[model samples]
Target: MALFGIRRLLTILLIIIRFRLDQLIDVTRLPSWLCILLRFGPWRLVPAPQHNRGARLRLALEALGPVFIKFGQQLSTRRDLLPDDVADELAKLQDQVPPFSNEQARTLIESALGKPVEELFGHFETQPLASASVAQVHAATLNNGQQVVVKVIRPDIQRTIEKDIRLLYSIARLVQHYLPDGRRLRPVEVVEDYELTILDELDLQREGANTSQLRRNFADSDLLYVPEVYWDYTRRNVLVMERIEGIPVTDVAALNAQNTDMKRLAERGVEIFFTQVFRDSFFHADMHPGNIFVSRKHPERPQYIAIDCAIIGSLSDSDQYYLARNLLAIFQRNYREVAELHIECGWVPPHTRVREFESAIRSVCEPVFEKPLAEISFGQLLVYLFSTARRFEMEVQPSLVLLQKTLLNIEGLGRQLYPELNLWDTAKPFLEHWLRDRYSPQSMFKRVSHRLPGWLEQLPNLPEQLLEGPRRPIEMPVPNTDIEHLERQLQQEKRSYRWRVLGIVLIGASLMQAELAHWSPHTLALGALGLLVLALK
Candidate 1:
């Protein structure tokens, strides 16, 4: 380690010792020698703090600084990993940080935008509206009289983050090497993932793009709203966006004052989440209460206003399909399908015993399903499922991890809005409808139509490529006897190839017409004719 990393590690050690967070670990689970060492370690000679293990851990993280605090926030979502008390305490870890001087913010913004603060905005507040680990926001008005918020990255934060991240890697290595469950817990991989996420937050331009994409995804929709980003004023270190006014989603009293339909608000929150994951495939991953608000205009039909698009999650086509199926199967209490889907999707090892995996899933899910639909937590169930699957050697999917965190945030927000919100009732129909649409003939036709042109372009070379395999010395056939046989065979193969090519062409044409004309009788006839041509071979 470098000098800075060593100093940072020592500082972390002091804080850990001060808080006595080592007690949070289960010493019995460690190797015998290590367990004995920990039990009689000199660190234990110091009188322990009065706080509980969870509190001590949380306090130690806070004392470590922004990066560790952020890690605590992420860890809190993994209810499947940490004990309940510890997770609850970590959930209390806030990203709030003291703001740098206003003059420093101004200088950074001016340097990023190549202009003075006065030239950039008609009015800019001297005090920050919100200060977080990576950046701070200030209320401002554009010269065009548009209300906006100016976000400036803390000057030299990158250096601080890099230093802390290096120390984190070092600590992760130590934990992985020393702890018994370290490989399973994946401390190193967890740190690597966190590094990518926190590093992304430093690039305001990427965040601005994410905000714009989310706004476009929810455009003209009442369920959620994303503020417009001012591209001209945006930079890698600075972002300016339209300011929104609404009740914070956590303020239940204020929302009630506005006659908000609490049940509707809660259901809409679930709808927004499903729509983002299944419908758009792009979702705001960091959707904690601080980044969400409720529009006051439509109390009867609640709309969510989301900000802080620094972290977003998306699913690939296969993941989306498997995830939807897994969710539906879980809701239907079909553990067999859930287990099968995990193996088929490569989430779990293919060699995993299906019945054993199914039994494991049932054990985790049956207890949860015993509760009333309204009381069950969809996110918590997923956490438990993932936890069980880990025993079958499922590698963590980063996208799914983000989705899990966002789901937990949404569920927490919904239950806060309305205690009796039935997440299963809200999400089941959506997943079913999406799955149906996903494999419908029209969808198949659309997919085939997209690839048909490329297939057609490649079709012309197929016969020649098939005939001439790899480069090799040509063998002369026995004079005229084999020549006639070769000629006959060539003729027969050409005819077969032509017939197959015609069948494919007809099939492509029929699918295109069916998609365009809504599957009329003519298109059906064309499809049948293509199948008949293929059958003739």
Candidate 2:
């Protein structure tokens, strides 16, 4: 792996020089010694960059292979973070990677399905409708005359992905070991996450399940359309799903011809994003223009058609709550609450002074508010917010990084679709509504209802614990070695449930004696569980 990594790194460096990427870096921003190294690097012989730096960068990444191409795909979304020319060039990095042999695709599909393609589908196209790094999709019609696409995994891609991932780890390690800011950057963990995400995409069936889940999430809504997964025809290596026909989201001219309400369409996009992130917490992490299209049925109130569910992002309950609160506070200009939320969520160092952090936040946010320009500046506001986060010694949470990337992508997308789109206006109402719904009495009841089964599952074993709770050697009948072995095993497992039940019984006794009339359902549950344990014993 080391030798392979070294060779691969050297080759990447060669490609970088071929594209004259060294010219892209502002060496003046680097330390003096690093600047010296750049001037004296092995590829200094390459000609200087002429123009189209973004194109050159994209070309280099494509040459490097799928892993690098994925990086380019992410960079393409953050137009606010990169030069406009470069972002435009990288945005052209097609998700449709060059296709593999149709013959190979058929063979894999046959192997996965235990039948020839002809037996399953009425017709399978020899050529793929689309190809991507991990898989390709061919247009097909089922025997029942349903139009669908057959998604087949790229041939022998696991080894290639593993090899590239190893190279990434090696590179991350080198940076972490050699640079002062390496730990702060967390290269190894980032590469690890990338590795997991890319590998998960290799499972076609998993993507199918994601599609099904998203479809269910918005079953009653028309804002976003998710293709239906044909489970009978799906496998881990091959997935079959309904095909969709819609105008590409990026085709502004096509949409305008359709008389789509641009402002409503743009706002709907924001609504979909927040709905997925905060409401469901299961968002399509990849929402680039290529994977999204505009449905034609509702031109007056535009709906979206989304595909490619290979990469999904989710947040924990705590993250979802804090993130909502943080965004709300940001809109309200409540710097102190924002700072307290950060500390409460442990996003920043606990030892950090709240007063100083609040002041720093006020400094960053107040400037943006003072600037006055509306929607176009929302993206700029995020850039400032992230910059402030980095400065306050806040440890960037890996779990939320996908959410961060996705929101930025959505921001860039909304701004492009409708320049007059007020992102905050669309988002604030949704956030407020979600927060209100989250704490409503009905919602709290639903939350308890969802978790009740788990607590109930632990109760059956509580009886066994209670029966054995008083098995003192002095009180027990003489035991054989088998019984002794059983006793030992039982001792290991019976630590908490028995004593907790006993404590609950004592509390219930006191409450009943005191004639407390309003014992809550929660208290009743504890008393009932204790009674069952004691009865069983």
Q: In TM-score terms, which candidate is top?
A: 1
In the range 1-537, model 1's lDDT, one tens digit per residue, is: 488777887899889888887776778778889899889988997778898889989999999988799988877866656777988999999898999999999999999899999999999999999998999999999999999999999998989988888778888897887776677667788888888998999999999999999999988998899999999999999999999999999999899998999999999999999999998899999999999999989789889999999999999989999999999899889999999999999999999999999999999999998888888988888889999998899986889999998998899889988888888889988999999998765675566578788867977786785565334344764687677787677777767777777777787889878668878878877877776787795
Q: Report the number of clashing residue pairs per model.
A: 0, 0
Best by lDDT: 1
Off by over 4 Å in 1: 26-37, 462-504, 511-519, 524-537
Show the colliding residue pairs in model 2: none
Return the number of clashes found in candidate 2: 0
lDDT, candidates in the order shown = 0.88, 0.79
Cα RMSD, each candidate: 4.5, 8.2
Q: In model 2, which runs have C-alpha deviations exceeding 4 angstroms?
A: 1-7, 22-42, 52-56, 75-92, 179-184, 376-380, 453-537
The TM-scores of all predictions, comma-separated, are: 0.90, 0.80
